[model samples]
Target chain A: MDSRVWDNRAWLFVVPVMAFVLFSSLIPMMTVVNYSFQDSMGQNSFFWNGPGWFQNLLDPTTAVGARFQGALLRNFAFSFTVLAIEIPLGIAVALCIPKSGWRVGAVLVAIALPLLIPYNVVGTIWQLFSRTDIGLLGVALGRSGVPFNVTQNAGSAWAVIVLMDVWHWTSMVALLCYAGLKAIPDAYYQAARIDGANRWSVFRNIELPKLRKVLVIAMLLRFMGSFMIYTEPFTVTGGGPGEDTSFLSIDLVKMALGQVDLGNAAAYSLVYNLITLTVCWMFFTYTTHADSKDVA
Target chain B: MLDRIGLKRGDEVHIADASLELHAGSMNVLLGPTLSGKTTLMRLMAGLDRPTSGRLVEDGRDVTGLGVKHRSVAMVYQQFVNYPTLSVYENIASPLRVQGLPKAEIESRVARAAKLMRLEPMLKRTPAQLSGGQQQRTALARALVKQAKLVLLDEPLANLDYKLREELREELPRIFAETGAILVYATTEPAEALLLRGSTATLREGRITQVGPSAALYREPGNLDAARVFSDPPLNELALTVSNGVAALADGSRLPGDGALGALPDGAATLGFRADAAAAAVAVGGDGRDPSHPAFPGTVAVTEISGSESFVHIATDAGLGTLVCLVEGVHAFEPGDRAEARLDLARAFAFGADGRRIAARPAAAPRREPVPA
Candidate 1:
């Protein structure tokens, strides 16, 4: 056996990337951790608070605590609600896309256009579109004699935000599902037909089961994106109407930049990060476990 | 017991017509070459696709308008049909579940099918856990669970190895006998066609060329094409000229026969003979110099020896191309050797320019079935 031929040179190539990631991610994360546990009052003068900020954030009475808790609940509800609607809608659209030719290409392009738009730009665009004065949507609603204010009403604001997010991100789920549908071998459908499966049965037994792997991926990605929704809602509503439309990220920004409470903001940010990571972890574990059982 | 069924497809095509009748408790094999409409015919029978102008009838009832689920036909595709995400048990039980069968019934059927396929130990294992042949058996078990009256096997064993193919061949007939369901299987291999040896038919260019017993079709083909297709080493065809009560081979040697050439053509005619037919009365002489001998001198062009017999390709002196003959054992004959071949006049067939038999000679034995309707 020629053990000397084994390559150790790959690590040398990976050294720069490892160093870059450490500087870009690990270093900033360390600074956030340091600020989380300490209170720096002025001019970089720091004192150890020993979990004082954590205690305050968990109290549910402080401004940071109230804003964080409210936003967390709202975000969780929004993500799940959006997920329930978008996943099925995406799969339906994917199923309708033809398998080949210019028509499929046109559909792919149309579905992908919204996903290509920058997130902040999506928020700004939706903000303009929801304006009561000049926006077409607002004018159309006005003509219908309905109260069409998105900026002043928290419910209307949340509705617009959810709709906008669905318009922008549902295509991603559809595209993933479309790719999955395309990869399904035609033999399965033929067999299903021969086994005397009707359309609904075919969809339920064959298509859905086969799409399980892709559906999991779409679900996880959509969940994480919706849970961490910040830029679009922030630009569209600016967290107005007494913190009703405000999410965790919006509250985090208010703590760090508005009140200049870096320690509390860092603690809030850490807690926010933990929540997103935990939810995502739970989703991944649950889906993978269920899939394994199906496999078994 | 699977009740008898019937189907009809009157789809017009540029080449040939298509119509098939499948009976319950009988296995029907669809044999054809490429582009012979075998798959299309199978799909129509399975109710996967509709015909332009045809109806499928079962037990004297019109079932053409019914969807696949309404019809009770199960199919095993050439590609394995196990649900990739589901375990072996789940895959087999799916058809039963679709029928809204009781869970106990589903369990019993799945267990029986799995046991028959030798997959009981791997019930909880997914499709990826099994090999290709095992996956195929899982698919077969799934179809069995469906309990459909007609089992359509579309080239089921096409992708298997030789040994697996033989094993499955023996197993498939057993299953068919046990279920007593009509089996309509498609295959391209002539050897596999012999395996069923049932009511077999050859579909060519979208039409049925011949339908009869496998052995009968093999022994006496109605036309030259059928004979050429049916034989193992194909029947040899050569051009000949018959003049004034004497039929001469293309090599200019007269075929020895005491028969009149009635209404014979003046110019060219096609002569046919199977390779295994024998020739006698060879005279030892220079290139066909012995006029009294019945043999014609030809050069042995090529020889391919296979264990018990050999295929000899010979070119005669009359400038005809290679003629193939099956000779017994190995013969030490090189290319360009002066060889004398005696004609087997009794086995020879003569056809006119229109590709129809011209000779009124009686066959070796009585042919069955009113000249093949």
Candidate 2:
């Protein structure tokens, strides 16, 4: 084989993407970094704080620090609770989808309808549908002797938020799983049948192994989306009945807009992003490492 | 044994009423081109697919509705399917494990198959880690471990390299035949069919053209379609018009029609020959004067010299069209050079207008003739 000649001209094509990233993400993120290091007052007046806000945020004794800790734990709880119900439910739904014919197109279009809805629209729709005073679900629950209120009950508020999250995003997981399932060759199923494998053995040994890559992707996307969730709960429960459903995104917005504390909000935002990135990285390496080990 | 199997999907008939009797301890080759229903026929025989029409009886019992699982069958698909995440050892052991065989028995069987396929060293690696031939070998090893009554290999050697294909082409049929299983191997290469030297079934457009002993079938194809199916470089076709016991082409070349070609009811017909049986040489005068053979002036379109033979493409004069001639020993014929092509009439077969053989394998010999003025 001939040795490849090194060409540097390809770097010019990457310049446009770099410039676009600079304007779209890097510059704005630099502003948050600037705020994290300074103290801000009314009228955009600022003083040099030199990590003082970050120090207080990490201490867990200050008011902002306590709220951050509470919101962080609540985010973990909500993320796990939603994912536990969504993953298995998504796989089941994906498995039941018709493999071929016009019905496949119809069912796929129906499955994707919820995902096409805008976030605020989904939140508002659920709010009207679950209201205790005039909502069908709330009325039915109230009449059935189950205490259901978004405003006065913490347990009920958590339930509605979890249910709404599941309803909104299980479709994402299911669609990803469906695509993965469709990519598997029909020959694998035939070969398994010839080997006399039963249904569970086929799923465990064949389908699950083939689906691992897509499942990892779905897990990461859903984990981040669930951990940073805000819109549905904000419109429905208002993160209230106490701080039960005030996840990290809701708490960050509250510190930034509701409390008008720019310094604390900026610091919280950076740490929240760092946590999400670190956890996702850890999960990816752990799972992929296990994957290579499984093959080897 | 396949009894009148047919598969129709929607309005398209994929396998049109095909039947063959497959016996144990024998090697059978399904020779056909792509989309010729070779794989579909094999799938129907394996019970992987149920025929839309007709029944499949095996061992004198009807198995049209029987699933592949309940039947003792193993198949290596064209696109070899091994558990991508499992080691080669496990891939080969999968069937034995499913059968709940003892660990010692499974180990011995897998080891034996691995040895036969030369896959012993790569037993610990996965399919993703193996090359195409090694992956194919892993799939073959899996099929071997089953020791089933019916084994189907769909283009198993098509993806292998030239040397590996030749090597496995010899070993596979022998190994499967040793188990006394009904082995059905499908390939598009007619040379492969000849090499396997078993019973050969030639298929075309979902129809079985002919099935018999391989060498004898190649010698005397039941019809023109079967003869064409058994040709590697594609059969050469020429139009012949026979009138009052004399056959002539549009280019003024002539042949005595007292032969099998004339045995046709004295009208327009087709004459087919193999590339190797025809020869093309640079014209040095006296080109279109031979009456006992097909002699026509042509212009060389291409010349390919390979190994010990040369393939010369010539566009014949008149409306005879282009024909390929495979000449033994190297011959240099450049493009645009005038040449003469001749067919060995003794080896040619004549077909009627509807593509059915009028007579098999030179039923009438060409008689010596005088040059036409």
The local distance difference test score of each candidate is 0.76, 0.85
Query: Which 10-residue span in candidate 2 chain A carries the lowest summed lDDT?
Result: A287-296
Error of 1 at A31 (Å): 3.9
* Candidate 1 local lDDT, residue A141: 83
Give me the runs in candidate 1 sitting further than 4 Å from their true place: A37-62, A98-103, A142-148, A274-296, B1-15, B33-35, B54-66, B82-135, B145-147, B159-163, B215-373
The chain B TM-scores of all candidates, as shown, are 0.75, 0.93
In model 2, which regions exceed 4 Å deviation? A1-23, A41-45, A280-296, B250-262, B287-290, B360-373
Question: Please, what is the TM-score per model?
Answer: 0.73, 0.91
Pairs with backbone N, CA or C atoms under 3 Å apart (clashes), candidate 2: none
- lDDT for B283 in candidate 2 is 77
Per-model chain A TM:
0.92, 0.90
Give me the displacement of residue B27 in model 1, in angstroms.
Answer: 2.2
lDDT of 2 by residue, A1-296 (tens): 98999999999999999999999999999999999999867787888999898888887999888999999999999999999999988998999999998999999889889898988888888887778989888888999999888788888888888888888888889999999999988888988988998999888878888898888889889998998788878998778878887888998998899987889999999999999899989888978786776541
* Tens-digit lDDT string for candidate 2 (B158-191): 8789998899988998888888998989999999
